[model samples]
Target: MAFKSEYLAKVYASVEKRNPGEAEFLQAVKEVLTSLEPVVAARPDLVKAGVIDRIVEPERFIQFRVSWVDDNGNVQVNRGFRAQFNSAIGPYKGGLRLHPSVCASVIKFLGFEQIFKNSLTGLPMGGGKGGSDFDPKGKSDGEIMRFCQSFMTELCKHIGADTDVPAGDIGVGGREIGFMFGQYKRLRNEFTGVLTGKGLTYGGSLARTEATGYGLCYFTSEMLKCMKNESFKGKTVVISGSGNVAIYATQKATELGGKVVALSDSNGYIYDKNGINLDVVKQIKEVERARISEYAKRVPGSEYHEGCRGIWSIKCDIALPCATQNELNGDEAQMLVKNGVIAVAEGANMPSTPEAVEVFQKNGVMFGPAKAANAGGVATSGLEMSQNSIRYSWTFEEVDKKLNDIMVNIFHSSYDASKKFGSEGDLVMGANIAGFLKVADAMLAQGIAY
Candidate 1:
């Protein structure tokens, strides 16, 4: 949607002009601003206070050099970034991604989305994100440790327990978080919960690993129930990506009586006619860390396709794109709608293109945006932060219960916002508006300090 409000168009134009060659960042900005066309008209004070402009821009964009030595004793250098986008509600809370695709645009877009995602959780977590372009794949433990340490050397200067709390994202996991946390502890000389996805022995919260995926299922189930008067029970599901989010989503979905038929990775996807074996996928992805193709090899009657995009072609009642950004496009969305897909929820940041979302919403498919849907991981991270501050840990069941409650509440919040904003059942606009109002109002109340 083109911006209807002049203020919104101007704000987006400024963002596009300021961040040239940043396709991902621009896309994120446009989506949020487009949703806020109603809000921009409803709250002129927000526009006058420059809240939209401030929200579009980061509070601090930190870029640094990380130099590490490879196993071959060759010095390697990678760029590390931190975009502290907002801190109106609380400290900077987001994840640090470590992938070769980690660039200014990706980090900025992730950070931008984090602002609202953290807000929608109703937790005092402002938005911030950081990462390095150094791919951790195929690297030995020692090599990864060195790279993480080097990355944290500069990052440690800008983060703290109450300042900026970082977690894991794509190409980042417990192992990487462990190395970075260890380095932060050594350098800062104080053991703090500056990072969320930590080792359990140190400060990690139980269920944090499974939080995002479980949370996604919780939200999806709620959306299905509220809008369609249905549940995941007996639904054919197709989930893209076999990483943490995909793995846990499959587990929870199956437990909820949904048959997940397909799972994928960057290289290819696997289709299991009967149902996906979560154990095999976990073994291939989490334990052995091998390609998802291994699942087809080990599990009989499963077919493996050589392209990841083909996973969306599988017929299903529900679709969860847990893969990276824009992995599902407009055409795939059209295909899903044609296949009788009733609901589509995102498990990754901005996984669906704008066109794809239009396709879903127009076709009457229940759409759950990422900030509201995939907030479980960050929501659990917020719980972990609380536990850290008090030096206490909750049981797995306790945390899981809280996670489910949070996800349910987030769904209603988005749903209510959609209804209030006159976009009944349109969670895309609802989530964006619902997430934006809290921060924007807070920014207004704080006396235009941006």
Candidate 2:
């Protein structure tokens, strides 16, 4: 169980009372607050200055209606949101997700998590997240373009290169980013780096697509080496989600001598007794835009399950939940623990429930919280912002090397922070306290108005 100080509990109770029914936001607040008991005890000034209260609340939360016409000439309305959670370090930086599940609660949770994730990267990025409840899965290009244009019409007024920079997440991808960037340029009447995950032809950095996944593996490998004197070599891995994060994680893990046995989409998961072939998976997913079940049809000696959760049932040395929030619950954690799983690293924000996290810790599974493990994508985004400012683009190798170094540093900082706080190896508490101290100190220095 997480340790919450008396003051921290009061702040959390206030957060719950103020934001009723926001389960995702409440869960995120609880997770981070519960980890900060020792920090609060050590530094009473944080409580005196109301840092926890102010940090829990966003600086600005914008919600707007996005009305666009579809291919069938029908006007569709969707809800859009941008929760600029913090700006103590720099501009608000996070990804914009486009999915049916996008909401205020989800955006707030992601934004809150981003504050710490961005801080851990040792970059000058504050935390923010924006998205709409618009599903891009079945939409035509024109429809998506129209929706993006309308969405940005409202979004442009609030964002600038030096203000808020949003990248892609979930249903938002290269095509959607292209559309949104084009619209932002048109509306703002300026060509600037207001968004990331751009095409290489424009102001996009190399290796941005693979940053999050590759970073996750790098962080996990460092954690393994530091805690267990092991690496990813010859380990069997299971990854959920067939999106960019999962695909690239599989690629990097395989490159590091790990055998990724399974990958999943929302519909189901595909298991390969042999190692997964990245090329075929990319072809099916990136080129064909099909589901995970299609891999079983094309690849030999592969099996497809009917549900996404069953992928956890496969025995593996490493498990990376790259899917949406709360996708891996307590039962799944128990299953993985029973199957001799040694490590679980999140590639998605808050993918593991509190109960699942407890199970992993109790069973001696080395756990990497999403904020620390998945900070690579935004770290590279910060690099892209730097490149854009200097009008220079680095090669893929250059960006990747920087990203790998950042992940290694993040792991050590978290490990050392945990040790300093007497937790020794609790990355979850270390990440929370390390990131919170950075932001809290900045906020206190800036005064209460921030």
Candidate 3:
């Protein structure tokens, strides 16, 4: 597709020429740049200042090798990456994912998306992301700790509490964060909020674990109520992924009177026609660290399927893709729209493919882009940073209330922007433009060097 703005076309061409073979990064860049057509047209001074071009490029890219000793005394090696995408708003803040899928392209895509996701939170955070190609599955506690320490030994040099803070993603959790934080403190000889998602015993916020999932439902609920004149009450919801984001989204959706009937992992999906039992799910995924298949084994009347992609085929009123990026594609999206799905909100970063997003847009499925939908975890992380700054903590209810308000405010920001931009109900564009405007304005005020 040809860009309507000549400046955007040139910027994209430069990105493609420079980032050849980086399909994920190129895809993310194209999506956001396309959404900014109206903004570019409305503000030509931004073009003169080169805002679009600069925002597409990272301020710094760091890559390093991490070697650690396994339980067998064999040396294991992995690559680490951190793409500090933008700092127009504040220090870089994002998560460090630990999965075999970690690569330059994946890290760049995530960090680029983080630029907008953090902006939507109305928090003083810029965008950054880091991770390793290390697969943590089936690893022993000692092995995990060794790897984290090795990784953080080098990572500590590039990060500080007020500079760049990274939390957890996919295979990373509190265990990983604790290990890394300990390593950072040892290396830096200082203790601070250099990371979020800390354990309660340390400085982690009360609702940090549940923030992303709960915030997803809160945002989706507002989307349904305002866009479709509907609510989660009596609606059937199918949520993908049984990890942190998926589990809490299920709990909140159920509490809001929605019957969450399905959950999934990379292995497969579980469909409990009798409404999901959140306790059983928490036990299997959280406590046992097992797959969704375990939920079927222990729960009566639940069926376990052998493919994660099949989750989207189930009939439902709402769908939340809390799994990995591009987990839901055009065919799966068609299935949902065909099966009477009324709303689709992302709980994972860029979970829906472009073709899938097109399907939702064409069918008027009340789409909520991941930037706006999944800003909760980071919002709470921002809150965690606040608590850490004051050397204090807020009660669970207080954090929960603040998270709710933030989600609500994010909804209105996206909704109002969509309407103002003459694309009412098109949250993908709304979120992209709303987030970019803040960062772009900041860049402009700070001069072209930014």
Candidate 4:
């Protein structure tokens, strides 16, 4: 199958012209569109209807100036962005990340990935993303609150419950969401489902924080089962990013009898032969907001390495790259294969480079792409929407069970699509085609809104 669609060329050209400096977003779009070449070729309606062109570029891109007073009374200004990429199926739904990496390019890349990720979840939610470059790493509560309030002051005007809803990502957690939502409420004077991932008292869903990580493990478990295996029992696991997703993945894996040997952050990783003490790790990360290297000091017989990339060198039966994109490359994939690693499920969007994916597939290692594995966050966000609409709250166990079922179904869908498209074991292709077809058809039916 060759790229026969001239429309793809035009679309890529348009993307290039529109986004000059956003290399990451362009790369993400190119990777996805390259996979959808066959679909675009077979169904010319997508091109004729401008779906491909429109899909590459976001529907709305918002850039606002967020000026807030720090604790020192010095006004700090940072840029805030919200890229509403698509809303064909439903309202704009995604997370609001606050980190030093937050930029138009990063937000666009994340939002572009979210379009297909939400589609694969089989939920009636569109794709969007919002964030700021304000790092919450060492900020005080007052400073964070002021920054979030200022960020939301402008963002509140554009978003709503059924129009565009935002959750939390990276540095934007329950606390950040609370501050943003409170500001929105103060401005608009309405307490609604304008945001997901809020505190339970403020209309957030149960199990939302743990959903992505648990969902990642559940998706990996399903991937293993599809390869004719059991659960993650007795498997040695290595996880990157000691954030919410990694921590929860560790929690679920340990609960399922898998021993997580390593967990890392931007600063470093801590490896414990006896398995990471997740409780202490949680306290250090969640409560104290400390670096992952601190875990070795609290736990005996553990080694700490200061750098995230070093975590990939550890031997494990399962490797969950729960950090950022392109964290794993061909060499790491080869090393994992040589070390007898059986599975690699991405807990972050496009965590593996193209070469890494090729190496893993060539070696027959079970690889779950981020669109399917990391979909739990958005899927649960959709569930949160459902609960909001129904005015009911599900218990943690109930929500978790449903999340597991959804991940299982997503895996089967990818497996079936791969087999149908002559890439039986390659879920990356399966997920791309399946997700693309869903959104493409929907867009076609909706007609050109722009």
Candidate 5:
């Protein structure tokens, strides 16, 4: 696609020509830049001042080697990366994913998305993300611990409560966060909210684990109320990914009077004619660490379907893509629209493709971009930082109430940003503009670092 802004086109072309084989990172930059064309065009000072160029690139990119001894005394070496993409609003804040899929491109995409997501939260946080190609799915506890320790040995140098705070993503959950924080404390000899998503015994905030999932539904409900004059009451929801986000999204939606019909993982999906029993689902994923297919076996009436892609083919009133990026392509989006899926709120980062998003917008489906819909996790992370600074924790209800307000405020901010930017109903445009303006202004104020 051709860019309307010549400056953005030049930047994209320069990035592509200078860095060969960076397709993933370039694609992420293009998606964001496309949305920002109008914003940059209207505010020529941003482009003239080189704010677009700086925003496209990271402030600092750290790459290090992590060597850890496994339980069997075998040394495993993996790469660790922290892309402190931007720290304009405040410190660099994002998650540390530990999937085998982790790379500079993947981290860039996530961090780029995080910038807007954090902005929507009305929190003082910029965007950044880090992780490794190390897969933790089948690893033992000791092995996971060793890997995290090794990873943190290098990471601790670049991060802090007020500098860059990392949280959990795909593989970096409670267990991973604990191990990483332990290493950081041991090395630095200081206790702080250098990371979010810690175990409750530590500095982690209450309701932090369920914040993203619950927040997604909260934003979705508000969108429904405003657009369709409806709520989650008596609605059927289909969610993908049985991980923290998906599981909790199901729980919150159900609690709000919606019935979750389906949930899936990388392995497959389980469809229950009745609402999925959240307890059983949580037990399987959280305790046993089993595939989602086991949910059907636990319940006699449920059907287990192999392959994650097929979950979208199921019929439902609302759809939450809680899995990975680009999971819902144009074809699956068409399927959802045809199957009477009235609303689509992204629980994962950039789960929908540009084509899929276009289809949803054209069809008038109430679309919530991941930045606006999934800001709950990071917003709560910021709250955790607050607690750490003050040396106190809020009750679960208190944290949840704050999360609810933040999600609602994010909805309003994005909605208002969309209208102001002349794309009233286009959330993609709204999120990018709302997020970019703050970062751009900050970058402009900070000026170029020589």
Candidate 6:
């Protein structure tokens, strides 16, 4: 177990007292704080400067109401949120997820994790996140456009190119980003890159769409090589979530000679005895926007399970949880270990619960923390910001090369940090300590105003 210094524990207690019922936010805070005992013990100045106390709190939090009209001539109202958790290093950078589950606690947890994830990228991007409780699944194109415009009407005032820059998350994709970006450009009358994950016709950079998923595989491969003397070649992989992350992860793993056997969505999971058909998945998801069950129906020799969690039961050498937070619990972790799983990497934000992480660590499963493994998206977003600043764009090959190098560096740094802090081979503590030290130093040098 990771140790928590007395000072760190006290600061976390204060956070819990101040923000009751915010389980997601509290969980994120506790995870990061618990891994910082060595830092506090070695450098008393961090506690003296109140870095932990200030870093745990967001610099600014804004909530607003978004009102739009549906196709049925009904006025729809949704709650919107933007939590600028920390800007100690650079401008705020994160994603905006438009789902029914978008609440303050979820947004804050993501924003808080963004702080460390951005730091690990070695990029000048601070942590921030914004989204709404607007479900875009069943909405028409016109309805989604109206809601995005309305959401940006208030969001634009709080964000800018040099300020907080938002990107796409769960429900906010290229289409949604295009809608919001157009609104931002119309209202501000500036063609700056205020939002990332934009279409190529705009200021978007290449390889941004595949960054997160590809990066997960890259980071995971590095961990396997360094820690286990293994690689992805000839390995079997199970990825949850059929979204951008899972799709690209499956693509990269297949390209690397690994057989991805299963993928899941909200409805259920599909297991292909042979390697999954990427073309079929792309057709069903990207082209048709249908469910995973559609893939099972379209492709022969495939079985579709009724529950999404059952995807974890399929035997595999690697498991990537790209679905959602807490999707993998302790029981799932134990089952994977019992089934001879060797590695577990999170493609989503905090997909593994504390108990699940403990199980993996105790059972010798190579665990890649979400903040380190899933950082490729934000790292490319930072590159996109640079391109926007220079009015230049890099080709897909160039951007992908840079992203791969970044992921490799992140893995090495985390490994070295873990070894340095006496938690050798524990990437969770290594990532937390490495990311925390960077932000903490920046905050200390910048003083308390941050």
Q: Which residue pairs of candidate 3 clash?
A: none
**Model 2 agreement with the true structure over 1-450: per-residue lDDT tens digits:** 444587888898899899999999999999999889889989999899999999999999999999999998999999999999999999999999999999999999999999999999999999999999999988888999999999999999999999999999998888999999999998778999999999999999999999999999999999999999999998999999999999999999999999999999989999998999889999999998988898999999999999999999999999999998999999999999999999999999999999999999988999999999999999999999999999999999999999999999999989899999999889999999899999999999999776
TM-score of every model versus the real structure = 0.99, 0.99, 0.99, 0.97, 0.98, 0.99
Tally clashes: model 5: 0
Q: Which residue window of length 10 is worst by lDDT in model 1?
A: 441-450
Task: Candidate 1: list runs displaced more than 4 Å.
Answer: none
**lDDT (Cα, 0-100) at 380 in candidate 6:** 96
Clashing pairs in 2: none
lDDT of 3 by residue, 263-301 (tens): 999999999998999999988888989888998889999
Clashing pairs in 6: none
Q: Model 5 lDDT vs. the true structure?
A: 0.90
Lowest lDDT 10-mer window, candidate 4? 1-10
Compose the digit string of candidate 4's lDDT tens values, residues 347-399. Answer: 98788998899899899899899989989989999999999888899999999
Task: Give RMSD (Å) of candidate 1 vs. truth.
Answer: 0.7
Instruction: List the candidate 4 regions with Cα displacement exceeding 4 Å.
Output: 1-5
Write the number of the candidate with greater lDDT, choosing between 5 and 6.
6
Q: What lDDT score goes with residue 44 in model 3?
A: 94
lDDT of 6 by residue, 182-275 (tens): 9999999999989999899899999999999999999999999999999999999999999999999999999888999999998899999898
Candidates 4 and 5, the one with greater TM-score: 5
Worst 10 residues of 2 by lDDT: 1-10
Residue 381 miss distance in model 2 (angstroms) = 0.4
Query: What's model 2's TM-score?
Result: 0.99
